[model samples]
Structure formats: C-alpha cells, structure tokens
Target: MPPPPNYPASARRNGEEGVVLLSFLINQAGQVELSKVLQSSGSSALDEAALSALSQCRFTPATENGKAIAIRVTIPYVWRLNQ
Candidate 1:
C-alpha cells in the first residue's frame, strides 16, 4: 500500500484541504523514476508534502507478457481536516 501523505503543519493551521493529482512513472524496479503534480491542492505545502511522500513509496511493477515493465500512472491524493 502507498504510504499516507504527511499533513503540513502550515496547511493544517490554515485549514487547507484539497486533492492533489500526480503523474508518475513506476519503473521495472518498482521505484518512482519521475513524478509531477498534474493538479494542485491550492496549497504548495500540501502539494509538496504529497509529492515527498509519494517519492518514498514502492509499487509492484506492471507486467507485460510475463515481463516487468515500466508504466506511467496518475492518481489523486486527497487532503482533508478531521472535524
């Protein structure tokens, strides 16, 4: 499972909440080779925090014809404050 993103203290203090859409390439080694923010959360701190956490993750490599292959994927990371 992908690790949860760390909530930035500044964002929490400001009650910032939004979804960050990220595009990344997962290589055959199951490592994140490249990543970028496709959509922002309206808060740089939250967006950055999401990116940093994602970089530390490892994923199962995609397979093609029984061989591991790299793939590009996009996903949304949601940030919300607990009531």
Candidate 2:
C-alpha cells in the first residue's frame, strides 16, 4: 500500500486535517491508473495533494485465477498537522 501523502504546506498553515478517499484502477502491469477522489477532505489543496501523491504510487496488481488482472480500489489518506 502507498504510504500517507505529505501534508501540503498551504494546508498546514491553515490547519487542515481530514481523510481523503481516492479511487483508482490498478492495471495488470502493477501501475496506478485513472486516479480520482471518491471523497474530499474539505480542502482543495489537500485533495489535489492527495491526488498528486496517489499518482506516484505503484501497486502489486490484483490476480485472478493465477493471472494478473485490473482492479479498482479505494484508499483513504489522513492528513493531520503536527503540533
């Protein structure tokens, strides 16, 4: 699974924190494809950062009947400002 995305600086200064749910397809070649936000964190910057980070992720593709297959997945990203 992809690690949590970095908190955006703009968001940090404004104290933005929440979970963003992303939906994407994992291709047979173990690549993240067509990523989009299924839910929002109430901040456009946070949402954009989450999508940007999600785009950089690579995954072990899902398998079916011993063969690699594309699968849709949802990932939740939590962004909290450090005190």
Candidate 3:
C-alpha cells in the first residue's frame, strides 16, 4: 500500500527536518507486529507521524532455514524541508 498523506503542514512550514529511526518486529504472517521509536526527530509531531506511517506499513516476513520467522527491522525516515 502507498504511504499515508497526512503529514503535518506545520512541520514543513517550520522547516523541520530530521531522521526518525523506527524499530519493528515483522511476524511470520508477513505483518508488522510491534512498532517502536528507536530514535526520535526531536519533534514529537514528526516522531508521531513516522510511527503512524510505519504502523501501517507491511513487510515481507523474514526467513530462517527456509521458514518464515519473526524478525526485527529498523526503518529510517528523513524528512527534509522543501527548498
């Protein structure tokens, strides 16, 4: 699925730009199970946005010895202000 289009306009207006590190556990069912913010963007709004987007993301399950296995993945979101 495509990413959500709910980014806060204020963040852009304020020229907010930072990296959000997201840690999530991909279950055997190829679905996102646990999601957490490994690193934040300093701004609560940006962090929340990154977390929300990641929560809705789907990923291919990890494999171990030719079988699906739960695994952890880290995603980074770099939000840059339009120049």
Candidate 4:
C-alpha cells in the first residue's frame, strides 16, 4: 500500500496531529468507489492528503463463492510528529 500522505508543513509547524477515519467501498474489480471521509483529523489539510493517498491505491477485491464482490471498509490514518 502507498505510504500515508506527507505531513503538511503548516500542520507540522503548528504542531497539529491526529487520526483520520474514512469509509469507502471496494468494488468487484478492486477499485475504490464512493470514497468519503467519515471522520476528520481536525485539520482539513491532513484530511485531504489522506484521501488523496487512498485514491492512489488499489485494493484487493473481496471474494465469495469464487466470485469477486464489493466490500465496505473503514480506514484510520494516524499522523504523528517524531520526537
């Protein structure tokens, strides 16, 4: 999977950090569908970056009875500054 978004410079300078939770559907073809941010990281910049990262990734399609199926997944993105 692609690495999480790079920390926003402004956020880093301002000491902002938090987790962003998101909800989206993985389609039968292993493509993201209907992506949405379910929770914010308290910073719009961070949230957008997370979403952008997710958009660039392709998930493995779920399967049932030897057939590919869509699945709903929730992801949490955590951002923390190194000490």
Best-fitting candidate, scored by TM-score:
1
Best by lDDT: 1
lDDT of 1 at 11: 99
What tens-digit string does per-residue lDDT give for candidate 1 at 1-83? 45887789999999999999999999998999789999999999999999999999999999999999999999999999983
Tens digit of per-residue lDDT, candidate 3, span 1-83: 32743666888778777877888888998888778888998777788888787777777777889999998888787777653
Question: What 10-residue stretch in candidate 1 is worst by lDDT?
Answer: 1-10
- Indicate the residue-level lDDT of 28 in model 2: 100
lDDT of 2 by residue, 1-83 (tens): 67677778889999888888999999999888999999999999999998988788888888999999999998898887863
Stretches off by above 4 angstroms in model 3 are 1-6
Better of 3 and 4 by TM-score: 4
lDDT of 1: 0.91
Give Cα distance to truth, residue 15, candidate 3, Å: 1.8
lDDT (Cα, tens digit) per residue for candidate 4, span 19-83: 89988889999988888889999999889888888887888899999999999999898889883
> Where does candidate 4 stray beyond 4 Å?
none
Q: For model 3, state the Cα shift of residue 30 in Å.
A: 1.5
Evaluated against the true structure, the overall lDDT of model 4 is 0.87
- Candidate 1 — which residues are off by over 4 angstroms? none
